[model samples]
Target: MSENTINAVTRRHWVLIACMLSMFMAAIEVTIVATAMPTIITELGGFSQFGWVFSIYLLTQAVTVPIYGRLADMWGRKRVFFIGAGLFLLGSILCGFASSMGWLILFRAFQGLGAGAIMPLTSTIIADVYPPKERAGVQGWLSSVWGVAAIVGPLTGAWLVQHFNWALVFWVNVPIGIISMLLLVRFFPESREKTDRRINFTGSCWLMLTVTALLTALLQAESLGYWTLVLSAVALLAGWGLLRHERYSGEPLFPLAIWRTRTLLAGNVGNLLIGAAMMGISAFLPTWIQGVSGGTPLQAGSALAMMSIGWPLASTLSGRLMQHTSYRFTAQLGSLLLIAGTAMLLILHRESPVWYAGLSAFVIGTGMGMTSTTFLIAVQNTAQFEIRGICTASVMFSRMLGSALGTALMGAVLNYNLMLRLPQYSDPVQQVMSPAGREQLKPANLDLMLTEIAHSLHWVFVVSLIIAFGSLLMSRLVPVQKPH
Candidate 1:
């Protein structure tokens, strides 16, 4: 490997620092808000609208990632990065001033529009700056930023809530974001030949509408009941229109080349499946640990922590493996490990020790690290520099879509199973799944309810295991050798 490809130049290292800061800022937002959610709701006095704060951010972020990415390719990464950072900072400042939940949600949506650009561009810039082999390790560094944020965000939010106003949580991002923007503007040089492509405004609108419809329907499925079906239909039709428009448009929002790349297609499918499984683990594992095994909340958290540790370690190692082996083999190893870890969960019981869960979590995390890193590096390598941003954004979008779909499906399964098991007390059974709900039930019925919930969780794990194996199958279809 050439020195320029294998090692970062001083300039590249500085760029990576800026990327890391931008990444950390976005990563922290994902979790930090959760810690202050209750306090915000209490202060804002819109209990019914509280969930919108998170939903709006995720929805806008997911919808706009590709748009920002394509614009980055057309305009330039530096300009795109600056715009994203500025918007994110402005939204954060506005959020600090929010007097009600409605205002907070609106500000969050604005923040998410900025985040859409920040995430994909972070990887795209790294790809531009680093070679394929080196990209894996650098990607690991970025992956670790999320892990670190997961650990620190809640604590930081808690500290801010206790010591200062909750607004400080949003205000904290302003300085970091500004610093990142300055570093990018000062240090990172734009080298790509900018594409003089016509902006696909119609395609962008249809794509956004489709995603909004689908995400909103999925999120509001329980509340909206039959109306969800109508929204889903609208989403399907809008998505079809978007695809048709992209197929004929001179400058498409979603490039047709994405559909033609075999490896990219397979890798994205695997990402979607893995993202779904990961969400299942995140959403339901705590309930299983505390309710089924009688473990403390701290113990449940430790299991997740183990997964975090395992992910970055395996991610860093995957980069080294790419130097010796093909991307396909490394990613396949990750898929196999994921299946193994999830398979372990099938055997878990009320009597299974906490270490068993922790070990399983760690192994699965390792698989995710390897698989995600391999896909990102491989896909970016396959695309030309001009379209790299969009390709990278596609992968991220797939993961987010997977998480939303997976959570919804798994939730349905959990609810259905719980309902079947306790047909008589339908209302109380679902509520009892929560810790506070468990406490509300009579002592004599607690074990019975826990057992029923445990059984339902078993089905959830079964769904995750199936998804992991599907990911493995998709990984097999990925091209073993990197494309020239």
Candidate 2:
């Protein structure tokens, strides 16, 4: 090979490596913290504040993503991407040193501020470098980052906690993030473009407040008591104000025209439903398997892993489909697969084998893979470069928003059914079922409580199946785009 050709290949390889590492840092945090939560709470001793560690990161990321997306379009990709990586690294360092849960949550929010830029910007950068047709395949590979993270994060977290301190979980991101940032600086290139410099700070504030209030309310619905209602109201009012502001602002944070196209409209709706259903399943599937099906934790994890496996495989396959077929068909095919998987879920019983759950998960994952990959590629194809970043960010934000809301809704369903059906034993049953509370259960009532827990989880799966079907219905509305 010629030296110039080898150089080009090397640059592309480094870019891909940087993208994967950056994406992994952002994605793995979502699950890696799960294994360390108990350890964190034990050492920090603010049980009530533990959820904030995760919640704050998600809330900050969701609200700020669009702002970063808009900024990326205005200032160019390199600066925004670097800023995000820097903030993320800084946050990781701070989190590692946090003296309390509150401090850790604050640091995590900082990390999320950086992450807001990372997720959308990574896709945008990929879009910038690759041709339109090749983007689908590239994105398919990128989508696997989440799957790999899902499988490895918990184990990595567990190992770190076992061998060292829980603080290492946060600290670990520092080196990887630094490497990613450095790679971008040394190798990544972008044209310095002149564009509209005016930023709608007011609109951004409104968005941040709106998303924070909304996500917090959803996340805390079961525990927030009357405060949940208050936050929900604030969210609604803020959302209304945000809409009006964005509609009138000189430089709207999220362009209103993107929502006008049938392709974007349908894609957004489908993405939201897909994200919602997927999140709901991930959050509750393990509980259902273990509590209802008498499966071991390993079995429960394997069931979830099946979905992870299916997602990337389908994602990779959809790109080839996009080469010869319409986006609508691939999307619909995915939706149907998901619906079929959910249907499988509906029939699961206490006697079902663990592999049965895994099989259902695999099918749903396959559908998710195809559906998400198709919508992203379709949305990008539908817009010009001027608004591509915003459009891309908007799609991502929708999915995150959906996942947050879906999780809350599913949790409510699970808890409500448990309370309603086993009123006499609800409180004690919930307590004993918790990891720390398992040993506290009265020896005589243990069997009865387990049975009740299983029954309640069955109802939760039923609710999840209904929600999954909703995604299938939404997928039908997505307009098919012929491959260019």
Over the stretch 276-364, how does candidate 2's per-residue lDDT look in tens digits?
A: 88875687778767665555678888899999889988998999898888787888889889888877876776678888989989999
lDDT of each prediction vs. the true structure? 0.84, 0.81
Q: What lDDT score is found at residue 413 in candidate 1?
A: 94
- Candidate 2 has its poorest 10 consecutive residues by lDDT at 1-10
Write one digit per residue (lDDT tens) for candidate 1, span 344-403: 888888799999998999999999888888887888888877788889999999999999
Error of 1 at 479 (Å): 3.3
> What is the Cα-based lDDT of residue 105 in candidate 2?
90
Which is the leading candidate under TM-score?
Answer: 1
Estimate the TM-score for candidate 2.
0.91
lDDT of 1: 0.84
